[model samples]
Target: EEASKIVTPNNQSQLEINGGTYATDSWTNVTPKILTHLGMNKHLQQDHPLSIIRQRIVNYFYAAYRNQRGNPLFSVYDKLNPVVTVQQNFDNLLIPSDHVSRQKSDCYYINEQHLLRAHTTAHQVELISGGLDNFLVVGEVYRRDEIDSTHYPVFHQADAVRLVTKDKLFERNPGLELFEETWTGSIANPKRILPSSKFMDQTKQPCHTLEAVKLMEHEMKHVLVGLTKDLFGPRIKYRWVDTYFPFTQPSWELEIYFKDNWLEVLGCGIMRHEILQHAGVHQSIGYAFGLGLERLAMILFDIPDIRLFWSNDSGFLSQFSEQDLQKLTKYKPISHYPQCTNDLSFWLPPDVEVNEGFSPNDFYDLVRSVAGDVVEQISLVDKFKHPKTGKSSVCFRIVYRHMERTMTQAEVNEIHKNIADASVEQFNVQIR
Candidate 1:
């Protein structure tokens, strides 16, 4: 299946992406606007807020963990290819074939068999299979998502994985054993207490021993808590909430109190033993965590709009640095441009199947295709089914505002008209 390719209806011989060419199919939905972001690597730029946060986390791990050779334990891979096979991105991660994330509305598929990864976790199993025990994968991820202050089609993510065997795990705690009924001695924090056995059983995989799971969980939380402290300072308020992921057993999400609201910053848990076994590592237990770089950068730098991270304006780019990361400097707003609001209302095509009907994401993509980043936020202001007619209608409010400059009403009108025309031509909708 991976080797098969279908020519697009346009009859283009090949589509270029990140310096490589590939055959496109009906499944191909990657746009030129999205493709333009492929090699941007904003996370690598020295003065970019995303890059500053990435380096801060990298430095935290380097200082916190050490390998047997007395070197930094977590190897960093920040320049990995954004394109990956379906198997690598989904199957290897234990995601179900029928998962909603596999749909074209959720992911940016390059073809039937390949896609731009939606998360950095796409590389976790491959890295483990290649004999990397502890590593960080940092790169841009793509998705078809709603337009808002915090949501963007492309964003950066950091995924961290660490593996430890019985010998390595017990080596630092010489007196402790893996199967001991209750061993709290290994916990470095004297004030902390282990959870009840019932809780442990509920959180751990049956294949793992309680003692081993506790030790691994403790280490994972210790390192991650330290990371949060390192980035946000020792006084940051945070809590862990139980969560679920396809690739991780005993999953959790960490949320920090920021700006009077609890914001989830990362999701992590013990790596599924089956995943390790599949990677040819039978005797090791590990933990893996993935966090959005933009999420952290926004809190640390007070970045309001997600689009500003991609801004080319010197005012936005010049406000961050490695030094500023230590000081936890807030980003000063450059200028607020006046927003132009336009509403796009249309009725569903009568012949369209319910399951195949146009989605808000389809409309969002159309707006993006016509106006690019000039359109800031899109909201479904009204949606209703017509009485007796069995027809659906939707009204979308698109806020158009440029990050670096004010957009003229005339310019916005033209863009909005283009979006409306494109919607009618593409979805055969009657505009209201």
Candidate 2:
């Protein structure tokens, strides 16, 4: 028997997902290809390797908290909640109103008020408002990202948070005590301080004390280290790097050594007190982390490409089974297809830098918009400066290949023509 085909709505005015209807407007950038991924809940499905990996991480943390802190594990919220308000996704996290991430090119908006959640952290405040102090929310997030082996428009993130305060611990158990030592070192110390930006200072809570924040930061690292070791094996080589995020102060990212490179696995730090305060937890400080599970799974399972997670081909997916977590199954390539290449060069306007308006990313987005997923890679191969005109010229090479099948030269030529025309019309640059 053949698999069932999904019925897409003919109306562009609204989108229906998991029984919820969102009013679609002109700002909607979600493509029909991406809409099919909604409600698939691959992370929650049985036998899905991504889902299995998520469960393994949850298990590791659960056991750690239970044994060390004498507290039960957090409740798991794994579902497809694509719809969230603008306030919840950006405003709740204290993101600036004019942040570039809020742009239509980078996000999928269902009107001005609602959008597909871009990160699992989008649901954090709602959980806190509902009286949960600790929880793990695993779900799909949307982005209008560039097309590549590693970049996809939709992916999964696991966001976990814990609210802590000395008073709350004493009130609940009367036995737990806050540690006294505080970190006193330069920001260069990866173990002691997270990477700082101007925003970190701007967002730090006035209610926080050096001692309290130090202890909370220490606890956050301890839990994350333990969890990481459990999932990647005890002797796994990893390092901490300073990073920045809107919702967390002194944010750090965890990078694990894999394939002879340091692959960033997660981003975390001391939770901004403003977030907790808005959630009605006025008496506590907390820490939170959001990690991309697909990146980790790619390393663990030796999955060659991010696109394989969406494959229905039994040959590609049958290698993984939910019954096994430690089984490292190396993915085998089914077939390699021929590649088609195209190049475009354009002149830069005098008013801006050589790299200003028609950025590589903008060009990539334009290519994906016209060619869909068939276009694989884009590269800036050549550049030149005209001595007389004082103008700069740049050339880019575009690679086109389909994962499962071959593409006709006619189809590729049409896409190339469209991209060239769009580049001229949209970016206002003369073709050379």
Candidate 3:
């Protein structure tokens, strides 16, 4: 079983050392690795001049970072990486294996057989059974990504994995309810807890369900937030959208809006049945997510240039001190204005199909555009044919944020008015 193979020392344990030979380093099953002499240059993977030199430099940086990572203050790091042997493969996360994201045109072709690693997230399935709470993997990743000020072919990824059960401390509180409420745009109903699902546990008993799954999501979110609080403060916002993936069940990408646009960060979901079977983890729940170092560096440092990561530009990196990161530990300053939340509905003729002219969904899109950072969310909370109006009406809740000063009702009203005006002009629909 895959799970057995991971935890038990392989009957065939192999370790490669010093560019020489792989040593069995074990008793019994003692078989010498038969070798033939291969020419010098043929033995090396690349002749690129700076490859070896640069690799050594990165090794030093990694060493220093790991040491600093142990400090109690640095727990939010979440990036835990372990190197793999030549024959090892890290499973791809979120995306389907047969997907174009896995094809040569989109990814680095590692070999005609195996391609360079795309993200550290590939380690998800493999490490699920490893005995650890909130484990993680961090490593250098190679992809064919276009190089730009904000792009790089070779970058780093930090993959964080967490496993929890009904017994954990988080289960006692039922969730970090207090934490969720403190943030604006958070789900306001204090009594309305995150949902869960019913699914089989490792025992093959039928138990998972949508409600339980959401509870797990909430639990994981709380764990991830607490762990990552040092780098990013409290009051994080979650952005969810429909997305597809092979190894996950009900997969979705989660983005948190920070500077301006929704800065997509991590991907997560419950593990797929096939994935659990492959991992030999029967009747168990699984969750996994990956974070891109390049993206985090950009957001944290306001780095518009992605290539700068590999620039070996000492000047660029030296600009920020480890000390500066301490500021991140504090709660992030809220937007100047208190959030203004309002809900509006529109009535349409039953004959009016969304495509016939303008619609409520379209109006919300425009609301999102003009509202920008101010637009917390535009949810189509209610929609149906109006019983009395003899028309279809769509109800939406809008939330706005301001950073400098609390947004006056008038300021919010102005934006609301624009949304209303656009709706009226859009489909000749009346606002209810």
Candidate 4:
């Protein structure tokens, strides 16, 4: 009975996550609220907006890419475990040991060695090593982030990887040369041309011919562009911006103009040869891409807040359905609940530097620990530096509202007081 307990004192508790029990340590920061979300698998819920968007993408992949037998080429894995080891989450993906993302403040570590994966890319090398050539991994990812309308600690991501051999690359285009100097005639969009630049030069690994790299890049852009068009229609305004990642060379982020703003949709690039070599897959090169499902669903469904995605309210859930997967129906406004606002101000610990000692995310987590999901958004409203003592004081405004019903001012006040007290106790911040 003791072993089956859900939580105990710090470092004494055994957390049961997805049927596996892990001992907690100083690095354990995953909240019970976060743990409870593990099995929700909102992405798999048939009538959920997330599942509808996922299915739409899955359908596009099925119809767009097919093998010789007319079967879908990309296998989908949506049930991968959310918990992963440090090696799988960071080291295997070539993330630097000292990378800022490795900080406990940025990730929900179950312990030093295990954590809720921050991205679906954690399974990339594992799948490749397991002999999957073309695949998609969709799962919930966790992060310690700020409270806002668009950001949530738990969200879903879809990651896709497709590999092609030299023979398979030229199988359809028999006239195409493997070592062609430039790929111009095959691509329909001139804007898709690989520009001559330092970045482009770096992407041309010695292990792959220029023609091979160009072919892969072209195919990747084609598939992604087709996907965006399929989701947003052919008239959607979108562009490709050059970006960098530790695991991929010559990475690019796809941004779409939606709701009068340029919103980034996804990041993709050709797989680094070394990553493939590490996976024991030789003579095959591929491209990998990942996109946040909530970002897309929010835009498609006109969701006003990211927190609404997790709402179990029938009003929110009933607005979406599996039958309307292809329709871009705007989400109807549910009843508008009045918001209660509270402000918290505190001084940074005097002993440490402001930037080194304090992280907003830590304060955000502290508030979350005390208030849970009743708080909708937290914004830094003011910051002051005492000229004499060189001390920093910061103020944040928290907006509290319940999705299902109105939150009474008295109820919000109690939660707000608890959050303020917890902030002081946990962060050593002097209340101001």
Clashing pairs in 4: none
TM-score list, all predictions: 0.90, 0.79, 0.46, 0.89
Kindly report which residue stretches of model 3 are placed more than 4 angstroms away from their true locations once superposed.
Answer: 1-97, 129-133, 166-207, 225-230, 235-238, 328-432
Superposed by TM-score, candidate 3 places the C-alpha of residue 39 at a distance from the truth, in angstroms, of 24
Clashing pairs in model 2, backbone N/Cα/C closer than 3 A: none
Q: Which ten residues in a row have the lowest lDDT in candidate 3?
A: 29-38
Model 1 agreement with the true structure over 295-410: per-residue lDDT tens digits: 99888888999999899889998877776568767899988999999998988888453346777787777777767899899998987888787788888999999988888899
Ranking the candidates on TM-score from highest down gives 1, 4, 2, 3
Per-candidate RMSD, Å: 7.0, 7.0, 21.1, 6.2
RMSD of 2: 7.0
Ranking by lDDT: 1, 4, 2, 3
Q: Which ten contiguous residues of candidate 4 have the minimum total lDDT? A: 1-10
Alpha-carbon shift of residue 387 in model 1 (angstroms): 3.1
Candidate 2 lDDT tens digits, 1-432: 000011112246777766777776666655555677788888987767788789888887677666256866588898737788999999888776767889877886767788889999999999999998888999999887666788877899999988866885445546454432352311222233333465456334445565567667778888888888777779999888977787787688998888799989899988876677677876677889999988988877777678778877777767777776666566777887788998888887765435454456556656766676677777778888788987888888888887788888998898788777767766677888
Provide the lowest-lDDT 10-residue window in model 2. 1-10
TM-score-superior candidate, 2 or 4: 4
Assess candidate 1 and give its TM-score to the true structure. Answer: 0.90
